[model samples]
Target: MDAEQQYHTVLAIAGFDGSGGAGIPADIKTISALGCYATSVLTALPVQNTLGVQALHAIPPEVVVKQLDALLTDIPPQAIKMGMVHTKAIVSALTKRLEAHTKVSLVLDPVMVSSSGHQLMEKSAIQAMITKLFPLTHILTPNLDEASLLAKMPIKTIDDMLQAGQKIKDLGCQSVLLKGGHLKGNTLTTIYFASDGQQHTYSFPKIETPNAHGTGCTLSSAIAAYLARGENELSAITKAQHYVYQALLQGKDVAIGKGKGPLNHFFDPEKTIKRKAESGKQGN
Candidate 1:
């Protein structure tokens, strides 16, 4: 490989799922699939699968800080995605490290609950996330359930989603994307609220399938990858959501586990790479 030939890079700081359904593995897969190189820092080691998370063990704050420090000093990332921050200590470390390097676009996917109804984060961590983590985030991606929790209300309708977006934004993030997958409807809508008072709505046909695990993780990582590839924020998000929609459509009914399985992150990444390469050539 030529030393001058460089690809976009996204640094994912998330938990590790032993089953490879979500967390760091899923983030890596999503980033790579979106035509970017992926690097990672582990926040926790969770024994999890499609069925659900079994256990969680968070990495120490000091270790997490060290990893960020080394990465920032060396090959710094253009975009960063964070998932499954299980402790307040880890949240603090993330905030501090990000404060030092404010150029990288940061996506925070608040992974608060498990698929099986287990709490994935502590109450203290929730407070810390809002206080310490939110202000540093470029985008706060939250699914319906998470939006409901953070917004302190039920999100059963589009109006509720709008309300929730405002509430989440009040937490101090630069923007909020409230995913409407959990709403009871044939159409899935994702609402975006930017700090500039601009709001955008994206709608796609809902894919009814059991193989939808890690959708949040995949979506956030994809957005980061797109951003790293030099796309505008809204364009990056729109492209990423379309990628997830396509991945879900391709992987529907594909059974890899007993319960809700993971998305086919390996569906097709080459097309993305080729398209990007052609676009670059045209630019020159």
Candidate 2:
């Protein structure tokens, strides 16, 4: 096969959201919409919808490892996006499997809670994630609430976000994208702190809408998609944010459920992107 015929591949490791508004489903939509082939490994099963999470069933560590092994061996991804790792065992399993894939760009959305206020991660797993997965992460995308929890500090303002981002970055990730969607005001600011001591702040008008389900998953997956297409970290994040913003704007008026609705992932979908496959590799 011609190298140019190969599609850029992105793998999403996340929980299963039956509602299709979040988790692996949202990741797939976001990745595919951004013109990348999407692969996934389920980490947990959360029984919930746009309303809230009711119950959860985490995948066993061994099974999760087997899934990772199968995908990593057969369909090696150029980039990876991880969400909803609910247990310390799963975190450890992921770290062990991913340690060798240092070349792959990894976007970790430290999903700790749902939009409806349900805890998605086990408290004990926080430390494990910081110690094990953070180092392997190319970019850690955490919202205000999750950042506060990880940094063990309050983040009510941009200054607080900057301080918390530094604290999280010190935990060993290559970079941190601190999302400030929860901050009060008409303008939303997200800060990106790079490993080289560079910081970029992105501010945009807040779109007032209740249909924001799966936003974090979408943004992180979009970032992974852009990275798979060979974009630099800053470029990837900038494009991903634009994608999410447009999705939210396009889907704002549309209603899906009684509770919060989801973004229009297919608002302006792009065809699958093709790239030259690296020699000896399936996709890149």
Candidate 3:
């Protein structure tokens, strides 16, 4: 593709989910759905299935740093999305790289907990994320469970989500997308906490499915991809949610694994690629 039409690439620094539901695979799918390329740097390897994560082994901190440096040295992405950092060492390694390279857009998905009742990051790692990475993030996307963990308080209601959103903003992020998925209800709400002190609430009718494994990863990556393609932050998030909703709707029936299956990231009802290629060949 020509430079004008070349796909923008997003660097995803996260873990590997063998389940393909979350982590690096989900990030790649989300980026592709938005018509962007994705480059990955895996920090951990998780033995997971549709049911849940079975085991995890974190990559060495120095190895993770080496991956980041290799990518940055050759070709820096238009955006960066962070997922699972299993230790304070990994967090520090990431922070050092970020400090060295100050000219990148970063979307931090503070994944402290897993869907199957497991803590992914140690207390020191969580603290390092708050101290080192939060300030540099263009946007931070954390679910209610994550928000509560960070806030050191329970988030049981919409009011709590609102409060947590502001508190997250106080942690130095330019904006926060507080997802309200863990709260019990038929409706799901997400709040956007802007650095300008403006807050906006987005609500969607919750789809009842046990297979919603990679929603957070997908959402954050989608936001990053859109931003890389020149969309404003708010606009990027809004569009990303729309894309996610459609993917969920498409994957509701297709079961790939025994546990919670992933949403179909590529659900192009129209064959846009084929049509574009034909048009290009015909000099249209």
For this target, which candidate reaches the highest TM-score against the unseen true structure? 2
Residue 240, model 2: Cα distance from true site in angstroms: 0.4
Candidate 1 lDDT over residue span 1-284, tens digit each: 33434567789999997777788999998988877888899988888777887887778999998988887776677799999898888888788779976788999999999878878899899999999988889999999989988999998899999988998999899999889998887999999997698999999989889998889999999999999888988998999999999999999979887888889898888433322232232211
Give Cα distance to truth, residue 273, candidate 2, Å: 1.3
Which 10 consecutive residues of model 2 have the lowest summed lDDT?
A: 275-284
Candidate 1 vs candidate 3, lDDT winner: 1
Each prediction's number of clashing residue pairs: 0, 0, 3
TM-score ranking, best first:
2, 1, 3
Q: What is candidate 2's CA lDDT for residue 129?
A: 94
* Model 3, span 65-169: residue lDDT tens: 999988887656778999998799999888988986656779999998788877788999988899989888989999988898888889999999988788888
Distance from true position, residue 38, model 2, in Å?
0.2
Instruction: Give each prediction's root-mean-square deviation over alpha carbons.
Output: 3.9, 1.3, 4.8
Assess candidate 2 and give its TM-score to the true structure.
0.97
Model 1 clash count equals 0
Ranking by lDDT: 2, 1, 3
Give the clashing residue pairs of candidate 3, or none. Answer: 50-259, 50-260, 51-259
Error of 1 at 173 (Å): 0.6
Name the regions of candidate 2 deviating beyond 4 angstroms.
Answer: 1-4, 282-284
User: TM-score of predicted model 1?
Assistant: 0.93
